[model samples]
Target: MSKYTSFPEPGDDHNPFQDPAVTQHSSNTEYATLDLYNPFDNKNGPPPPAYAATAPSAPQPVVPATTPPSRTTPTEPRNYGTSFTPQTAVNATTAELLRKQEELEKKARELERRERELDSHALGPGATRQNNWPPLPTFCPVGPCFYQDINMEISQSFQHTVSIMYYYWMFTACTLAFNLISCLSLFCVEPSGGVGLGLAILWVLLFTPCSFVCWYRPVYKAFRSDSSFNFFAFFFIFFVQVIFYVIMTIGIPGWGFSGWIVSLAALKTSVPVGVIMMLNAILFTAQAAMGVVLLKRVHSLYRQTGASFVKAQAEFATGVMSNQAVRQAAANATASAAQGAFTGAAR
Candidate 1:
């Protein structure tokens, strides 16, 4: 047996360490020869060499300590590079949604508050829990002239006093139109008919605009603004309007050519003219009635506002005393009266 041989040949069954090739390979690779009795034991391996030659070592990379990335569920998309995680993004989105919802709720409450305030303002101080106006007449006998309908619309569109004033004004206008038509019809049938027609047309054109500017508009403004000055102005102008209407009804001929008397004079020759005159009389009567009604209504409203005769007198005094023209006129009148008295004494 050679000195390097650590085991017997493979065919030698009596010896348990038998494979020569395995023994030789093990010896070349620096492993211990297998002991057959303790082949599976860790203690059977050869001991390490006592003296190992140290070699110049290569520099090792300084690697940071890192934990392995946790496994994510297959359904979740992996985020790269960005610091925002899926849970953090979800949390931020939920917060933003909640903030927007809160803003919307706040706006809704504010809008509701504003709407309530507007409704209260529109209702006015005198508004009761129930509506003030009478309900629509269920059985309209006149077959729907739309009077009730128009009244309802006006009530909805305007304040209570304004609605009443508007109705009064509307009736006044109707009566005025009837009177005008009657005047025109009489003039058409009269002698010197062309001149009469021209005068009637001119009267209509001038008076219609004048009436609106002087009376209707003032009344409308008075009711709408509830201005005391405007109300007084309306009362004076409407009084003048009523006086003019009375004059026209008397038929002075040249003034307005509107009198029922002139129309009655034409009646002997023309029956239609007499009928028109009668109709004009009726319209004028209606206009007068409406004027009285409106006056009463205005007075009632004025009283409701707590104004008295004393207040009216004060207003009148202020208006008169404060006017430069009035002061000048008074001064002139006083000087004239003094001069006249001095002259009379001299005589």
Candidate 2:
């Protein structure tokens, strides 16, 4: 043996540490035990491949299945009529609104019809009003100057009053005629009393038309149109007329009135003539009494109609301002005044 070479120990070939069979047998037993005891193994599949023992199997990506949410149904049933919902409430409200809108349209149509009727009651567009007052004959040269129908023009509530007023007007005319005859008779008795006959004629001519125009027409228009200004005019002028009637009823001798004094004076001359004059005085007194009664009645009606002085003033102002002829006249007057002032200044 050389000095650098190592010597083999006794029984080296038979040692278990160096034996290949023993090492291989121990490794096989360990592998079989691990295969049987592993909690993560799959027994139903084929055994792992031989190379799988050396390296781990690649982990598979898990793709979970998607599921929709469950919808639950109502357990209890409901009645259709009694059951309430947001949709049903909204529908009910819409129907109510439509019904109210229809009612409003009906009311508006009714109002329009009423307005047309009111317009037609007056002289509406293209409607001609014929002159019927005085009831003159067709053969006569003089024709009716005014149009009047109490039933058609005046309201039912005021028709009775207006008729009475008309009768009073006729009575006044008859009284004037009687007074004229009485005055002529007195003039025949005393020639100097011809002045009384002429005055009586003038009064008959003047007072008849004047009374109709100043007071009677105003009352008619006031009742027809409920005009406050016309009411005021009727009251003022009718009061003056009533005062004149009372004065005439007193029967002044020379004033052409067939009053008590004049009638008594005629009794001294002739009994039949005095009787006629007394009859005329009685008529005059009756006329005065009727006039006073009519005035009271008319004033009561005016009070009921709620007329006032302030309303009359306002109505008068509005009527004057709105009248086309009045406005034209006022404009002309203003222009004339301005021209005159300018001319004077130049001079």
Candidate 3:
């Protein structure tokens, strides 16, 4: 033992269990301890014979997490009306079907409402300017008619019409007065207040036809074009009339002038010319006021429709009230539908 001498090498032929004294340190050595009877110890079958132990087993991993969304599952049902649809991740087809059904119901209710409204005092198609609001004609995705018709043709024609009308009114009044005077002077009792007669002839010959040419043709153009066809035509005719009015002012400077070229000879027939002048002036004045009022009405319509002034003014000037009614009706219809759906669901 002092020299660390070894005993005879353990015999290969001798079993350690049968020859115990030489293997006495085995109880204190490191080794695995598994219980053969434990289910988990099977390891798909059973632990190897050498690795078996007698201790109890550990817990399993098959169970899910302790904290999950399902932890607070509601004991009571959560109810919402059909309108308040809550789609689940699971059946997309069912969700789509539900959405389609709601849309169909909405459409049906709207149709029924339209029928009821029609049975009442509604005037035009969807009168009061709600559903009947015509979409602006366009050349794009929304509409088929080209806006060019309104922009290039109708608008221009409208302007031209206004201008032509202005000139036409001025010309008609002036021409009517001059022509009537000429005809009346023909019957004047003073056989030759002849200067009056001559003046009347000159008016029929020069003033009437010239004014007609100056005013009426342009008016035709205006109706066809509607837009500002020729502002100068307006200015030219207007300026000429202003000059005529000034020269013809109450003093009657032209009345003293030679011949019908410069006389109130048309006044020879008091009744007809007087009536003509009165009607002509009246018609012209009314036109001015009528155009202005209509323009204002059209502009208001444009603002409500989100249309630009440059586009056109074809819509009616009734929006604030009409739109509000549409909104209120839609809301009431939707609410009623929802209430009915929920009531049915509850039942």
Candidate 4:
């Protein structure tokens, strides 16, 4: 008589499928991962034939949730709500994927329920159901294994985009306020006072719009696309401006145009320069911190798309990925398939 027992005897680590009795047990698993792993194994036995139960020879039909009355589905708009598809692994389009995921989740839940029913009917919850599970060798990540998936890589990019939005908002506020106030001052002040009134007018009317279009737009696009080049360009322009402003603050009397009223006689030394110098120091520190943050973000994005920056110290990554990964050949292909979804490429 066949040893109906499915489990390997104790002290066996590698002989799960040796007993054919439990080999086919995972046929009912949600994603059909029964073949992936089997735990109960014994090396010393004749491989058992799978003990798959055969219904008394009748085939089962897959019944739709709601069968159509007669052949009227075509005429009456066969509204079975949403059509479901099995969630086998593959990259399907959005509509197909939503349907697929729903089916997989449904299957998983149903399998769990059936296991519960069998357990309750047979041994009950407190009683072990080790006999019920298929022989699995690997750790099974069944429920919510979605989080453990590499798919979360896409999810993380979304999170990064949110953070970039915050930065964009901050910069937007600074730019808008500075331009509005500075431009207004230019208009109100006399032409003879400070820099040329023509320059101020041009700065207000021209530079504000131009900066917004050229700099801010690209930065925003970089944030959305998670691209490396956009980030590098943004920082390069931003820090250049920061350095210029710092120089102007130190070189000019009041750290701003027309703010210095001190006479050369009163200011013999760079002693009055202390506060401005300190403020410049603080600005530099802030810029450095900002640069570090952008550096980290750009590094992460470059990992997504092969780009490099000075701060990205992962020599293995920046140096190698762009070269051996068939970088140029893959880029156009990836970019095209991704649609215009990627707003910009950075440095």
Candidate 5:
């Protein structure tokens, strides 16, 4: 075989095995057909040579020339909704966390303020509380003993109710004073009535402070602190006081109250004294009526506060157990009993 072999041209009818005469006769016509068949003559120059036709670099993908995309999106044709950027998502989450932190800080500050109020009321060390009641002069020998300020200590909702009670207490004191004057008038009319006058004086001295301490202070504390035990205490003591008011309004002679009966009897002795006694009776009756109204109002408030006897009992028990004096007394009693039993056993 030759190193350089020419391929057989197209359209030759004779092979090498055939006669050379037939091959030579077909060669000219084949050559002429091939020479005239210019595949790219008028279109392109010529077809590429065989050597020039390679496997072709894997057809390079048509890449349209692209400029860097515009920072602003095109605003025509199709509507694209706001696209979410990572920075926007990050900022939204950060803002939410900051809002929550601010809320928590506000809550913490409110809690701290409430704690300070409680501490002040408790009269703890460094407390801002001071005695303001009995509002005596600075130069007075006796200083104020109680810290009492409805506007400062009581809640806004309760201030009106508490103020009424305070005024009622003052009214009660005034009634006692008038009762004393009425009894004095009766004593002037009848020397035998001196006993009633003395008793009336004693009543004035005793009851004025007792009513305040027993009932008024308790209810005040109950409303201020929402203490169930204090509410129960006020109810009990005030009910008893109301009963006493009723008894006094009846004007029992010798018992010291110049009530209706005494007033009517005094009418036989002196018109002026009877009139004064009747006025005292009216005051006592008013006191009893007011007491009843107050009791009803206080009970309604207690119910609204959701305080029950069960809660009161629990509070009382806890208070007793927590009291330093009560605990010390209990400890001493136990020690004393144990000592006594040990001595007896040794004997």
Candidate 6:
């Protein structure tokens, strides 16, 4: 008491330096306290406490456990936007592939059906569906006709000849029909109706079949076959028919009923008959022209075959020399001539 004054300081009651427990408590308080304003930190509030900074963060704001939308939903509308994800793209690609596969299957089935139909309808090898009636002739005449095996390789000139020949045949057939009708009309007007009718009937019965067999058929065969023999036979027969046509056109008065007879009957009886006859005359004239043209075409065909009078004579000689029947006939004729010559001398 003599050495030091007994005076109490302002913080003597809580002397933190003198008491360990006080010091420890003060440290704990300091650590727990937050600095609302700190010069060291640029943040709006004070920095985190040292312990909090050192410790692991309270498990980061637990992210919501979410599942992505399914792309495979059939009811979902297609998203055409550029924002589509990879999963959606994969689904769209798979769907498109399936659709295309279905389309391909349908097309394959259709093609298979068509192939079966074609196979069923197929007639024969090298034959088509168009091989029907009415004989659709090809534009190129030098080819196959109605018959499969029968084909002709003719020149353009020869084709023109064939066409003209067909026209001639048609004209001739028409002329024959016209002639028959005219004869019938003339017979109706004639005084001897029965006789005229009989003649007309006879002419129709005889000439119709005869002309077809002798002339038209031969010509048709010639064109179809391109046979030299058929051509020659047609020319000979047709030449005779043409002569008959001319004779019929002349009309022998009472015996034969013809276009000319009809015209004569028309002058004597009916104007209608005359008109019909005149029309017949026109047709006959046209037919004659056609015949002439056909004859020229026939001659052209003949020349193409290297036929001539000399060739004809050579053929005749060859045939006679080669044929036994012809040779026997010729020998008989020669013997008869000699016998007659000898008999005449003796008499």
- Best to worst by TM-score, what's the order? 5, 2, 6, 1, 4, 3
Top-lDDT structure, candidate number: 5
Candidate 6 lDDT, tens digit per residue, 1-347?
42375445664574546677666766664354443435456764544565456546668788888999776767865667756678978999999999999999978866665665567456566665432222555675554323211112233335556556655665666766776677677667765656655676676668765765676555555555455555676788888877766766666665454556546656677778777776876777666666766777776777676545565456557756899998899899999999999999999
Over 227-309, each residue of candidate 5 has an lDDT whose tens digit, in order, gives 99999999999999999999999988997898999999999999999999999999999999999999999899888998889
Which candidate achieves the best TM-score against the true structure? 5
**Poorest lDDT segment (10 consecutive residues) of candidate 6:** 144-153
True-structure lDDT of candidate 2? 0.84
After the best TM-score superposition of candidate 1, give how far the Cα of residue 38 lies from its true spot, in angstroms.
99
* Cα lDDT of model 2 by residue, 164-258, tens digit: 99889989988999999988888788788888889899989999988888888899999998888999999889889988888788887778888
For model 5, the run of ten residues with the poorest summed lDDT: 46-55
Better of 3 and 4 by TM-score: 4
Every candidate's lDDT: 0.63, 0.84, 0.46, 0.46, 0.86, 0.63
* Per-residue lDDT of candidate 1, residues 132-204 (tens digit): 3234455844332211222222222344566665566656566556656766776666655555556656766
- Model 4 off-target regions past 4 Å? 1-191, 194-198, 226-228, 247-306, 309-347
Looking at candidate 4, the ten consecutive residues that score lowest on lDDT are: 144-153
Which scores better on lDDT, 5 or 6? 5
Please list all clashing residue pairs in model 2, or write none if there are none. 251-259
TM-score of each: 0.42, 0.62, 0.26, 0.28, 0.63, 0.43
Scored against the true structure, residue 84 in model 4 reaches a CA lDDT of 44
lDDT of 5 at 246: 98
Q: Tell me the spans in candidate 3 whose CA falls farther than 4 Å from its real position.
A: 1-187, 219-229, 249-347
